[model samples]
Target: MNYELICGLETHVELSTKTKIFCSCSTEFGGEPNTHCCPICIGLPGTLPKLNKAVVEYAVMAGLATNCEISPVSKMDRKNYVYPDLPKAYQISQYDMPLCKSGWVGLSNGRRIRLNRIHIEEDAGKLVHDRGNTFVDYNRGGVPLIEIVTEPDLRSIEEVQEYVEKLQMILRYIGVSDCKMQEGSLRCDVNVSVRPVGQEEFGTRAEIKNMNSLAYMAKAIAYEFDRQVDLIQSGEEVVQETRRFDEGSGCTEGMRGKEDADDYRYFREPDLVAILVSDEMRKSIQKQMPEDPQKRLTRFVSDFDLPEADARLLIEHRRIADYFETAAKGAKNPRAVANCILGQMFARLGTEAEKEQFEVAVTPEQLHELILLLDSGKIRMNLVKSTLEKMLDTGKPAKEFLSEQDLAGMSADDLKAVCEKAVAENEAAAADYLAGKEKALKAILGSVMKATRGRANPQEAEKLLADIIRR
Candidate 1:
């Protein structure tokens, strides 16, 4: 029987606050085992928790960026659980009164994943297991986090990946968190279920916890869905439980039975006061929010006339989009600037991480200078491309590599003489051109460009070569 996979994702994003959410401890990653923790973060008996103001503002900005409504009033609650990593045993978080509500992120496939809520919470610490011995580190304890819960709107693995990627791009563009999955700054818990095709009701769902990377998450979801379907087909019950993805075997092993809300035993925390976000504060944060990547993508297409695929590449990262706009502002053809970025510059950046960091030696202003050279028609496109490579390699400005002879440009008479010489040297190509072979003209044009050392206008060279071959 055909079955459809149903899935929902719970994404936990660590806010980039200097200090932990409820304490003054450093929230930096990769410190000595417990060096970054403080008495308050470790939940000493007499210590009381204090909320970080930056955490609230950052969460609100994230909500706004994702089309969520900012709650005017929200309060913190206690989520009680006994885990070695959670120093307090009860994490201070928002429950019924979350800071953001009813948000949604649109996917490229015309599907919208509706967010249940975005709640602020504190992160637990790390657990290191070495040689069958377990060690706990509270360095990440009390680190600020925003948990984005989505409804079961994801039906396929493609949608799951696209939704996660879209969320990452939006979160990074707003400068909230780095969303470094490897560092555990961002992770997802996928809830997977499967039912027969055309089944209206969702089958029992299994929760897979702490998927750090997208590729692994996809594999986990695919494996879990099939496991659930196989159970239903064999007439065995599909129990709802927590599972872990076994990377080595590409299978999911059961961890424990899934717990409901009552299992957490949530209660209000008396240490912190009620949180209030006035319209004034919301407006201030809205002003600080960057332009939506989608809106900027539309502008790139409408204003710069770039192809949609190329525009998508530019807007993938905020810095790359910013650089392209800055350079295009001074160029005669914005499309040329876009082409240079999507074609040559992107080739230099080898990986996704490199593309995200965008650590290029060429400055946006220097790229503007290069594009302006093309704008003024002083140098041909081939010169622009080659000079750009030199500028990228040596971190020098375009003027340093562009000699006077290169920018002086070939005069019309000199260009015609060169084209005549190229046709005379390649008689077979010139004869082929006369025999109605259009590609033969390209061979002669290549010689003209080589003789002129890429300073010749391609259009003018092709035209001159065609006229010379006809003669």
Candidate 2:
């Protein structure tokens, strides 16, 4: 606790372009081993590489959404590295002049995590390890990616989570990438260090690479922080190296020595020309960009009069927010629609994947029709809820389950008649209510609901029954 945690993150988001960054090969996920690759992807001689225009556009949209400055001129650089997954032995990436720079992702705690840069690069392939031999899949090789690097601004585990989640939300909202960690669409490399509370100098950092889960990432950073602090207090130095998070042990194991930027031997790529972003191009991308998540959150709260918490839950995914807007377009009470989504509909969506997809049996239009019935007073909330369950079960309209008599609704006189009948049958309950047994009123209310087949409004029936009992 005496040491302060200092952390920075490097997030790699694979753009959903149809083709690779510098090759025409398919970037589709889950292809057969090496089937999607061409001669250019494997670094064959005399195979010229061309940049994908969509990759540039997608990168620009991401930059604009994150409040980054788009560079007018940028160039690709070959980062020399040798790995089995990287068949090219060198990666085509941006180094000196990245596509986006100086951006900040804001945390809910009001702290802005300063972004160092966001650069486009080609992704490496996958390595499948068997008993002893390792097989390589070049299908993912040359897939276009954008690396978002942030300065050492994160100070706590909570901040680290908020930062990553917000980035994922923004990337998915803008349609550049899905940011699914399970599918390797998004991954992070965290640099963690510690210093004494009163010291300004940072301790040596250990970089934890390819942490896909936010929970594991937080644990790794916490363990690494304590590890560094212990080392410093014991008169030992923390080593700067790359590490992998051991999920079973909840600790980070050192992989290799961390390389500085110079280790990559970055040089201007002769195969590709410089990237130019004119005002016209930037404006075009801006028009294609969707609304910011923060702005949308503000609009949802102010326009729908939703509680901030409810609004947040609604906007956590883009599809859910869109579904809400469609269902609550002109409803009298938008909160009811929010309830049906966060409550009844969410119950059926068992997993986070289902919530993200939001594929429900009931359509938004169908839900709006149901809410309209409640708005018109044709059905009470209790009936609405029950009918919604049926509607969800059968994927049918409210009328499919609602009888004509039920939809007609119980008139005031009809409700009073039901109330009187219930009081006549339950004489003991009526007497107990007058005798100051408040709990007995619920029994009488239950009788009325049963007699009317749950058609009578509880509020009206209870009030009418209470008045009749006093007389």
Candidate 3:
């Protein structure tokens, strides 16, 4: 009676547009409650909705980036629901005909997860419930969102995680959306079911909602599978329902019985005009689409001669990849540039939050120049990282900080003097070295590096040490 779990995910990524999907309201997040709302987004009387051209273009870009087949035509339908957050009592969305469909994202394991559809929709406002009263904020109303639904091709929790990571990276690379899960710009709802190993039909599926993180999604699915298996073993039938993922308890709790599609009573909007995407428009979007993450990953590995694992890590963020590309240009060692950026410069930037904060002020060009200067021996590696931190903290450029701190790399003459001084001081180690003690030479090299305060070129120091030892 072995049972296997089946999983699918529905992810909503808010488009990074300047305005609302069907109105002129600003799409900025964390604004004053209802400050960005207008008559149309608030569903005031006699207001007609107009689609944002940027929204449609972003959708097409996303579709192409994900290997989806962009539909020739699509239109918005009204999804009716009764929540205080929904000012219009209905959401404008795509139903039968969506923006794209039949796409697939291949995993590292060679398993392909099929995309059911990617549809555009308007996000609902938010409801902040207090002790006694619930307040409705129309700030989020009418914001553009793309709903990406995947087929039930996922089997284990690990597969779901890989599929999600790859998808998020692709979206970020294409410049379509920011896909920040913590800020609620991206959200996921997972459907999970289990069946006997040989069973042809799936068991009752449980839809888990409000899973904000990848770790939470995997844990929630794993917990649900265990709960279902236990029920089936005890001869109790699994009931379909909508469940909430409790972060504190790390378990799924029933929110309500699963609502049927008819519960929303979806219909076409009468006020808005139908969208007509011509071949020319589709071609324009296809041309504008940036390189896909997977494609870029492969290219980074081949073109830059990076290890596959290193390329993957570098490509995790668009800014990081851009920095690597810029720094590698006309440099002696692109691999060294990659290593210094990730290993030293980034580490000097501190935590993820600090890095993001620094990113607001520091450009990739600045970091690229720093890497080049350090790699070419224009500045010592240790001083380069220290100067970068000062540049970030004080808003000073790298060149200015380098001059003020006098942290430049040692000149060949200065390095030779330090190396000579090191050999003069460490007579015991030098004696041991000349007496056929190879290990003692390494100790003397360390002394030379220390004497120069890590400013001397390590290679030059090693050469000077060996020259002295041989003499």
Deviation of model 3 at 102, angstroms: 1.0
lDDT by residue (1-471, candidate 2, tens digit) is: 499999999999999998999888888888789999889998888888899999999999989988899999999999998889887789999989999999999998799999989999999989999999999989999999999999999999899899999999999888899898889899999999998889888888888999998888888888998788889889999988888999999988988654542388889999999999998999999998878988999999999999999998998889999999999989987999999999999999998888989998899999899999899888877788898999889899888988898779778888888888889999998899999998898998998888877878787777888889998
| Backbone N/Cα/C clashes per model | 0, 0, 0
lDDT of each: 0.90, 0.90, 0.83
Worst 10 residues of 3 by lDDT: 353-362
Per-residue accuracy of model 1 over 1-471 as CA lDDT, tens digit each: 999999999999999989999888889888898999888989888999988899999999999988899999999999999888987789998889999999999998888899999999999888988998879999988899999999999999999999999999899888899899888899999999998999899998889999999999999999998888889989998888888998899888988744542387888898999999999999998998889988998999998898999999899888899999998985778988988888888999998789888988899889888888888888878788999999889999999998898888778999888888888899999898899999999988888888888889899889878777776
Give me the displacement of residue 79 in model 3, in angstroms: 1.6
Residue 94 error, candidate 1, Å: 1.5
Residue 300, model 3: lDDT of 86
Report the alpha-carbon TM-score of model 1 versus the true structure: 0.95
- lDDT of candidate 3 at residue 467, scale 0 to 100: 92
Q: How many clashing residue pairs are found in candidate 3?
A: 0
Question: lDDT score, residue 88, model 2?
Answer: 71
Off by over 4 Å in 1: 257-262, 427-441
Give candidate 3's root-mean-square deviation (CA, Å): 3.6
